[model samples]
Target: MGLFGKLFAGPQVDMAKSDANRKKMRELFNEVVENGQDYKLIFGFTEDIGWFNYGFVHGSKTKIGNLIVGWNDNSQTIVVVPTVPDLSGCGDATFYRRNEIRKAYQSKYPTDAFIIYPDRKGYIGINVCDWLEDEKLYVYVSQEEEVKEFTDFFLKRFQTK
Candidate 1:
């Protein structure tokens, strides 16, 4: 879109307040996670974690909640938990190729921001702005043991023959 086109763009859909859109996004997230992939959900608001530049780009902070981090085995891609407006009050879930990933690991900071790099071009910092936390559940799966435990629990609750 050109500059004038952007200025004339239609009103953005407020997914945060729409049930249909919320359901769609939730399903999309589930599908992304259920394909024999590994994922972690971290609880806490964006501010507490700190991805300052991203926050600035997004126009605001992520509402306090869970941030889903997942690794897709088939593509070797690390999926950034897209902001679900209705659920997160942030934005939408977006994907990035593993090669595009500059880094992916837990932040060394005291607050522990689970980070995925290439958060922004030429920028280095905690990338919390991408996830708009809203849920209360916090499930951290950083270690091998934790991943196994989470897998067991997830399969038991969500798997179907």
Candidate 2:
């Protein structure tokens, strides 16, 4: 190793891990397509990791590919966290409530960005942009692999069913 290289930090081997994460995210997103009726979503690691920064509550199991949603009556425009989290009302109408859950989960990882796609009823759809805030994927991606990542994350969860 060069003198300067040894003195400073080394290369990041975590890139592989990030790619794996992206793939999983794609899987999860596709799985949610069938039941996108009412599923709010968020993009906080806490949502999936299950923990709150406030320490009041913990253990939030994200529905794999759901978006974190919220409503602001005063604004009358539906303010969402990280990204907008509306519902589609595909399966359960509880998507509205799910939005709340996303917010609750976001307490811990505030910077964990996510993308919420809502249907006509202002219902959120899937995590179209779960990795948007990821530093690894700072640039826009339009490759087939990107889609696969979301699909994998969504479908994998439904395998048990």
Candidate 3:
């Protein structure tokens, strides 16, 4: 490596690993389509509280894929993806409850940059441009009859189904 490259580079990110993770995220998203009416598309990783703490709560952007999957105890899985996919430079998941989870998971997974949060209400708000329109996505699973609700929502809103 060049002296400048060596000196200026902050910790080197494993591109291969990142790509694999991204691929998995994409595949899971496709799974949502294939499964149809069985899964809800959430916004953040809600597989577990710890994963949520790492990926969403901590504000760590993977730069891999803009999605994650979570399954409820009853075998209901929700695939979470962002419509405003580019969250590279600036991104944030705001909320008190999320903040609390992020703080607690910090020590548990100190070096871990991203962990998938499952089965929780996660939302992402984006302001594209002043002239353009703003978009917001809220990913969650309802306790009531959510299959039809989520399926219809995904199909009508995102046109992905």
Candidate 4:
């Protein structure tokens, strides 16, 4: 490979590293949540929202790293964790107990509250409403099955309420 080849090559995405990171994230989630095996794990990415110049921008799609969501139907709890590809940038997993969430819904359009994040595009937007001092947890997933799984879980739990 010459200098031209190096320059022409696009960003190198290490799928193996990404997979390992996802696994590590699941392990971390299990460590925090009780009866982790009972929870359904949904893999996705957390949008890194930021301000540029005078308005919000998409920034990098996966700059914040992978996102793993653990949902337990029996316990009525949800755990959200963000894991970096290298595992060093991992943060504390957020837990949403049964009584903690006041409401939840899916937003087709990105609201002002979530405008800073990436556009909804073709991804599914799940808004976990009124949890952790009114903080909103917005998760965007690209896969069709993942979208169905997440929406089904939340809609069944919160929509009727």
Cα shift from native, residue 110, model 1 (Å)? 1.7
Off by over 4 Å in 4: 1-23, 54-65, 86-89, 111-144
Error of 1 at 44 (Å): 7.6
Error of 4 at 148 (Å): 2.0
lDDT of 2 by residue, 1-161 (tens): 78988778544335555555434433343354333223322232213445455566555554333333322222222223231122222222123222232322111134423333333333333333424433432322223453454344433321112
Q: What's the lDDT for residue 130 in model 3?
A: 9
TM-score of each: 0.37, 0.26, 0.26, 0.53
Candidate 1 per-residue C-alpha lDDT over 1-161 given as tens digits, one digit per residue, 9 for 90 to 100:
99989889955444453334434444556665555234443212343334456644744344344434444444655454544334434334556555565555555575544444565454222233322323233222123443454344323432222
In the range 1-161, model 4's lDDT, one tens digit per residue, is: 99999999965545565456446656766776667777877754445465445355444332333556777777776676665434444466766665655444455555311111122333223333211111023222223454467667766764423
Residue-level lDDT for 147 in candidate 2: 42
- Off by more than 4 A, model 1: 1-45, 48-66, 83-90, 119-161
Q: What C-alpha lDDT values do all the predictions have?
A: 0.42, 0.33, 0.32, 0.51
Estimate the Cα RMSD of every predicted model relative to the unseen true structure: 16.2, 14.1, 17.0, 10.6
Worst 10-residue lDDT window, candidate 1? 133-142
Badly placed stretches (over 4 Å) of model 2 are 10-13, 34-43, 47-161
Model 3, span 62-143: residue lDDT tens: 3322334322223423333332333222122222222133221111232312232322664322111101111123222121
Ranking by lDDT: 4, 1, 2, 3
Model 4 scores worst on lDDT over the 10 consecutive residues at 129-138
Q: For this target, which candidate reaches the highest TM-score against the unseen true structure?
A: 4
